[model samples]
Target: MATLNGSPVGLADMQALALTNYGHFTTMVVEDGAVRGLALHLDRLVGDCRTVFGAELDPEWVRECVRREVSGCAGRRTVRVTVFCPGLDLTAPDLEARPCVLVTTRPTGGVAGPLRVQRRTYHRDAPTVKHVALYGQIRLRRAARLAGFDDVLFAGADGLVSEGCTWNIGFVDAAGSVVWPEADVLPGVTMRLLRSAHGRHVTAPVTDGLLRSMRAAFATNTAIGVQSVAAVDDVVFRTDDPVVTALREAYAGVPLERL
Candidate 1:
């Protein structure tokens, strides 16, 4: 289901996104009228709206739109809240910005994980914001899948690991500390939630050379809360890692906020 500002989305409303594709979005897992890190997701929407549209977004209104879309959903739902200017013009893009909220929901079941990912050197435009310009990520992910991998792990030209195609990458060191790569990737809500709940994480530079010193790796996102990484190219990590188990538990234990 899709809605624009609590109303049904129409073809005209989607034209701007298809033509310009200038917007920011946050995806979250909504279950039983509650969400983990709901505040973070809302904050991301508000901040990214200001960055992309030079306007303000009401988080409470966004929440209400989301609630309207998923009010009667059963089981689990994946909700995407996109902030965009539906009337945006490419030639005269500086017109007074009027950002609109587009909310969409889809039924979600089990999470796929223990991913075998391949490393690729690439970066995204406006890496700090979760924007809709995802050509680079989609291209690299497709290439990785065609090359016999489940997904792509992105790194910089300097060989420092950053993140996955659509998730944040985390490592478990020998000392069982959670290691987040210090890169210009998007600050994922799931990553932030895990860091707060686990309380034993550090931000550091992660490179291919440092993978040997790490014990295990995992992927964090709204869909798959914490998924083990079986391999990153030739380097394989233990899927039954205890640290990963603890992380999953910790993520599950985080209190859910009601909408």
Candidate 2:
């Protein structure tokens, strides 16, 4: 089921979403009715709504709606909450922008195995807000898969690895520290939670060459907590490294919040 402005909506609401696909959104994987980093997800909607639509969305209201929508699920479910203006004029943007929340739920249990990625020089706009400007990313990911890879990793013009199409990239440095790239990337909820669990994290600019020299690496996201990366455009990584195993266990140790 899907909802629009806290009310039940169907295909018409989806059509409106596609027509005005100019909003910020966030997705969380709720397992047995609990989510990790629930506050972070809500805070993301609040901050992004203000930045995109010039108005703030009440976090409590959105939280309540999300909980109500996914209340009856049995197992793991993917919940996507979007904030948008229904009657926004794209031609003449104004300050009187009021946004509402739309929540959609679906069952999910897919496993993201060790990923093989292809690097590409692509820049994303407003990397903080998770908006619907994802056609380019989806296309690139599809092309990567067709070309015998798992997904695409975005790199800067300076060859600094930023992030994946939909996941935050992490690495295990020579000193066995979790190194988070200090690039303009969407600080993902999973990565944030991982950092909280593992405090020995270093924020540094990681170039492609530096990444190749790393001990092990993995990708993090809400859907798949931590998945190892086998290779990134021919530079193979230690998929079964002890550091990767430690990260997986550390991330799994994070507690989930109810709704």
Model 2: pairs clashing at backbone N, Cα or C within 3 Å: none
Clashes of each: 0, 0
Expressed as tens digits, the lDDT of each residue in 1-259 for candidate 1 is 8999999999988987889888889999998989999999999999998898889999999999999999878677889999988778688788888999999887776878699999999988889999999999999999999999999999999999999999999999999888999999999999999888875889899977888688899999999999999999999999998989998999999998998
Please list the residue runs of candidate 2 whose C-alpha ends up more than 4 Å from where it truly belongs after superposition: none
Best by TM-score: 1
lDDT of each: 0.91, 0.86
Q: Compose the digit string of candidate 2's lDDT tens values, residues 71-119.
A: 7777888999988776664565564777878898877778767999999
lDDT of 2: 0.86
| CA lDDT for candidate 1 | 0.91
* Candidate 1 lDDT score at position 230: 94
Q: Model 2 residue 228 lDDT?
A: 94
Worst 10 residues of 1 by lDDT: 104-113
